[model samples]
Target chain A: MELFQNLAQGFAVALTLTNLLLAVSGCFLGTVIGSLPGLGPSNGVAILIPLAFTLGLDATEALVLMTSVYYGAMYGGRISSILLNIPGDEPALMTTLDGYPMARKGRPGDALVLSGVASFFGALLATIGLMLLAPILAGIAYLFGPPEYFALYLLAFCTLGGLASKNQAKSALAAAIGLGIAMIGLDNSTGLPRFTYGEIHLFDGIDFLVAIVGLFAVSEIFIFIESHGKKSAIGVTLRKVTIPIKDIIHCLPTMLRSTLVGFVAGVLPGAGASLGSFLAYMAEKSIARDKSKFGHGNPRGVAAPEAGNNAAAGGALVPMLTLGVPGSGTTAVLLALLLTLNITPGPLLFQDRPEVVWGLIAALLIANFVLLIMNVPLVRLFVSILSVPPNILLPGIMMVSFAGIYSLSGSGFDLILMILFGLLGYLCRKVGVPTVPIILGILLGNKMEDALRDAMVISNGEISYLFSSGISIGLWVAAIVGFVLPIFLRPFLKTPPRPAD
Target chain B: MTSDRIFGLAVLAVALFYLYSATAIQLGFLSDPVGSRTFPYLIGAVAALCGIYICIKPDPDPNWPAWPIIAKLAAATAVMYVFARLLKPMGFILPAAVASALLSYLISPNVKVSIIAGICLSLGLYLIFRAALGLSLSPFGDLF
Candidate 1:
């Protein structure tokens, strides 16, 4: 009942002309950006975060705008996948297998519509799960002691810094570096300044924004320069556009089932949307009587991954909102932003910040419609947008980035940091070290300390309290399972079981 | 052939750094129970162990960036320095446009249109953030 009332309030906020316009613009802008092969959601979010900040909306409103862009990007990614056999990002790679086939078959419009509806249904179902699960988690969270929190924070470090990347050692190295950097400020518990090294800026600690932008945005551009000098190959035909109702009905059961699969994968600490898409795609293909047609324009093939990816996006939010644990890379960036807003997301988040959470839910529901409407008719425009010459397009993006950095602050130092970080980021990618966990390490680094301190305070100086609690034990059980499941499940990954009868 | 082992050893070396720094921090008795550096110490130990394992048995890696590409990127770092050093004196639009053009050149010099696009985009940015959104352009004090 409270969820319903809160939802209604969110709707009231969402329906206002300002938010509606923002949602519509975000969706339109998102699809345009996403249609470009290399300008993925991460780049979109990184570039736009400062702009979103400059708008100075209250935290909820800012979140609403960005979340809208997120769903919009999901809608937009398929355009490139269908037109050009290249996916814009990892999550969309599954879409390309069947989507490009449909384009070759002169049914690109059907592919677009089916993908949109699948994204909507999957996101809607997962949002329902989030609405129910978040409140319950928040309620249970009220009872957690400091030691429990401390252990949970350790779990975040272990899961991300230890388990996420290919090399646990390097991940641990990144985590250590982040922790060492985090320790630069004056110690809160003790008034003694540590590691300030006589610089005023060091007293504030190294800004994760600096690390994140340097590592992600700039490095990405450098990699693009080296790897792809030509237009990211894509098709751009505005063929007859409108998928049939029967086709959508046929994919409905697949969407619902895949949503559940995606949501479950989303709940696990490390396995994110890529795993969700792989599971959903193979599951649908396995169950189909016509399994042989999967890679060759089977409509169900496109529906399954689209549904899985969108649902995973909604599902990934649950851990972040409920426990301050981010299940994926982009969400990790959002977690960092949430901290900068002075909003610590945990169990108390639901009680304290209903507007931010609920408004987001409200905005997501409306955002799907925004994406749907934008996708169905205007997809032709978005498809045509892919034709922009990379020469002009790449420079344009670089210019906008330079201007944004310049306008945000007159600080020449940040510009240097951005370029330096960009180069480092490119190197990290080349080395096969995932960038997401580093962001997660930076985001979670400080809080783990706070949780540890609280746990110590209550334990009367006994470190064993972390292992002593029932909740702590349960969390560890889950974390251990999460940590090892990926390794154990590696064999089954390529060929996920067909939907069980 | 031995780079794999060396890489693993490098990881271990990082871990040792963490362990040394983290454990070195002193936590006083009871009054300030959870003093600063306690969490860092814990993470430091975990990193050190992981590092030691890698040092003992390193995984083989085949692919590395080409030496020439790495050198070219190193040279591009000089361009970034110029962008920062000159952004204000040259005005937001001009310095930004030129800096962006140089960065785009790093992507490819064959695409002549990217530079033109860079100039137009830089000017557009001057209009949007400076003229429209009312953010202060990187101010040119006497350098202009």
Candidate 2:
């Protein structure tokens, strides 16, 4: 009953004219960005952060706009996968395995419409799950002390390295570098500067937004430049778009089961959409009557990953909202947005900012419907986006990044700092070091430090105090297991088609 | 010999430098029992250990691009640096236009199309940033 009341109040806030317009535009831009090869939801949201800030939107409006883009990108990723055999992003990689094959068999229109419906089904159910699960999770978070939070953050870093990257050492190094970067500027407890090198701009820490844009957007331009604008050819020409209702009904069960698997994967810390999609596809394949047809343009192949990845995308938001810990790379970016807006996301957020939470939930619900309605007729429009040449797109992205960063902080130093981070990101990618943990480390470093400090103060500097509680002990055990289990499991788990967020 | 080994070496050097710097932090009188330096020390140690591990067990082969591609990437990076440096002195339009043109040219060698794209992007972004978004960016810096 209270959930209904909260949801009704949410609808009232989200139905406003400005919020509606933001949601619509965000969805449109998100779809276009996501359709571009290699620019996933993380970059999509990172690129648009400057615009959101420049518009001076309030907290609810900004979150609503960004979350809409997040969902839109998940929907849009299948476009290039089916049409060009190029997964638009990492999670979309599984979609390409069967999506491109399905397109090659003709009936490209049917393949696209079926995937869209599956994405819609998966995302909608996961959003409903988030609505019910987040409140209970928040209620439980109220019981967490400083030790528990410290242990939880440790678990995040450990599992992120263990599960997401091919090399846990490199991921650990990236997290260490990120924490080192976070330690710059004036210390919160002590007034002394750590790594400022006497620059006045170093008084305040490096802005996470600058790091995000530099790493994701600017490094992308460098990659594009190296490739020399060569990959814009469309592989499959679309016939007339169709509804494909029969395929939708046939794949409904696959979508349902994949959503369950994906939601669980998404809720697990550091296990994101790529794992969800891969697991869903593997699960479906194992249970199929005829295994030979699984990867050879089977409709279920397309439907399962599409649904699983989208559901996982939705599930990643649960930890982000309820516990203030982002479950995925994109959610880490969103966490940065919330912090910039001066909103501390956690159990207190529900008590203090009901409108922001409920309104965002309502807006996501609306955006799902909007995407379903908009994607079918606008399929032709989004397909055109895949043909946008890199020459134009790269420069345009560069301009947005530069202009946006400059507009945010009228400081030249930040621009230089951004470029430095861009170089670091490029080098990390060159050496197969994952960038997501760097982001997670930067996002969580201060909070982890604060939690540790608080715990120490409470326990009079006894290290055993951190392990005294059952919850803390459990988290520590989980962290150890999460970090170690992936090494042994690596042989069994299928290697991802590409590096994931 | 491998790119991973070189990267690992670089990380090692950075971690050592960071550790040295961590030892130099001046603790305040009212600092907590854990203190600010403890976290940095822990991070430095972890990074150093990871660096050693990566160095000892580096990946077999890394697919590095050709030297020509590396040169082009470096050139593109130089343009971005210049753009950042010139953003304040020359205003948004001039620096943005020049940087966009240079970057476009780097992507493809067509000069005319690059310039046109540059002009369009700079102007289009200006309108979006200044007019539509109401951001406070001067078009021509202090020149006009």
Candidate 3:
């Protein structure tokens, strides 16, 4: 009953003219950005952060707009996957396996419409799960002390390395580098600077927003430059638009099962959309009557991953909103947005800023419906975006990044900082070191540090205090298992087929 | 000899410097029992250990691009640096236009299209940021 009341209040806020307009535009822009190869939701959201800030939107408006974009990108990722055999982002990789094969079989329109419906189904169910789960989780979080939070953060870092990167050592190194970067500004407890080198700009610390834009958006430009705008796959033309009602009905069970798998994967600390999609596909494959047809343009293949990844995307937001911890790379970016808006996301957020939380939920609900309605007729429009040449596209993205960053801070130094981070991001990519951990480190470092300090103060510097609480002990055990299990499991886990470059 | 080894060694050097710097952070009188330096020390140690691990077990092969592609990437990076430097002195438009043109041309070596696209992007972004978004940015400056 209370949930109903809260949701009704949320709807009132979301139905406002300005919020509705922002949601629609954000969905449109996110779809266009996500259709581009390699620019996933993280970069899509990162590129648009400056615009959101420049517009001077309030907390609710900004959250609504960004989450809409996040949902839109998930929907849009399948476009390039089916049309060009290029997964638009990492999460979309599994989609390409079945999506592209289905397209090659000449029912491109049917493949696309089916995936879109699957995505809608997965995302809608997961959003409802988030609405129910988040409050209960928040209620539990009220019991957490400093030790529990520190252990939880440790769990985040430990689990993230195992899931996010191919090499654990490199991922750990990236997290360390991020923490090192985070240590640059003035210490919160002590007034002394850690690594400022006497630069005045280092007083407030390296802005994660700048780091995000530099790493995700600017480094993308460098990658594009290196490739010289060459893409080999010719897009499959959508000759006719047809609603695949029969296919939808057949895949409904697959979508339902995959959504369950994906939502669980998403709710976990570090298992994100990529894992969600991969696990969903694998789960469906194991249970199929004929495994031979699984990868050979089966409609279930398209439906499974589409449902799984979208559900995982919604699931990732659960930890981010309730516990102030992000479950995925993109959620880490959203975490940064919430921090920048001066909103501390945790148990208190529900009590203090119910409107912001509830309104965002309502907006996401609306945005999913908007995406379903908009994607079918606009399929032709989004597919055309794939043909946009890198020359024009790269420069245009760069200009938006530059103008946007400059507008936010009006500081030339941040621009330089952005470029340096860009170089760092490029190097990390070249060396197969994931950049997401670095962003996560920067985002969570201070909070993690604060939690540790608070725990120490409470326990008079006894190291055992960190392990004293039941929650803390459980988190520590979970962290150890999460980090170690992946190593042994690596051989057994089915590697998803890589999209042809 | 591998690129991973080189990268690992670079990380090791950074960790060492960061450790040394951690030792140098001045403590305030009202510091907590844990203090600020403890976290930095812990981070430094973790970084050092990771660096050593990476150095000992390097990836077999790192796929680096050709020298020309590397050079082009460097050039684009340089343009961005210059764009940052010139943004304030010359205003957003001039620097943005020039950087956009140079980057576009580098992406696809067509001079005419690059310049037109550059000018149009700079102007168009100016309108979006300044006019539509109501953000502050100078169109032209006194530097020129």
Structural similarity to truth (TM-score) of each candidate: 0.91, 0.98, 0.98
| Candidate 1 lDDT over residue span B6-103, tens digit each | 65566567657655655555454434466776666666676566557666756566456578766657655676678777877776766767766776
Residue-wise C-alpha lDDT for candidate 3, range B21-102, written one tens digit per residue? 8888989898888897998999988888888888998887666788989989889989998888888888888888899999
Candidate 2, after superposition: displacement of residue A213 in Å? 0.5
| lDDT, candidate 2, B1-144, per-residue tens | 377787778889989999999889989998788997999999999999998898899986666778988998889889988988888878999888898898888888899989998999999999988888898788988767
Interface RMSD of each: 3.2, 1.1, 1.1
For candidate 3, lDDT tens digit of each residue in A1-501?
999999999999999999999999989988887888767899989988888977889999999999999999999999989888887788898998888888888899999999999999999999999999999999999989999999898888888777657678887888888888888898888778878889999999999999999999999998878765456677788899899899999999999999999999999887788889989999999999999887678999999999999999999999999999888888998998899899999999999999999999999999999999877867888888888777778888898888888888989999999989999999999888888889989998988899999998898889999999789899999999987888888877857665453
Candidate 2 whole-model C-alpha lDDT, 0 to 1: 0.87
The Cα error of candidate 2 at residue A44, in Å, is: 1.0
Residue-by-residue lDDT tens digits, candidate 1, A293-348? 88888889989998998888788888888888876666676776677577888877
- The C-alpha lDDT values of all candidates are 0.71, 0.87, 0.89
lDDT of 2 by residue, A1-501 (tens): 999999999999999999999999888888888888767888889988887888989999999999999999999999988888877677888998778878888878888899999999999999999999989998988989999999999888888766667788887888898888888889888778988888889889889999999999888887777665455544888988988888789999999999999999888777788888889998998999998886678899999999999999999888889888887888889999999899998999998999999999999999999998767777889988988777888899888888888889988899989988888888888787788889888888888999999999999899999999898899999988988888888888874352111
Return the lDDT, model 2, position A227.
60
The better-scoring model by DockQ among 1 and 3 is 3
Clashes of each: 3, 0, 0
Model 2 misplacement above 4 A = A229-234, A496-501
lDDT of 3 at A185: 93
- What TM-score does model 1 achieve against the real structure? 0.91
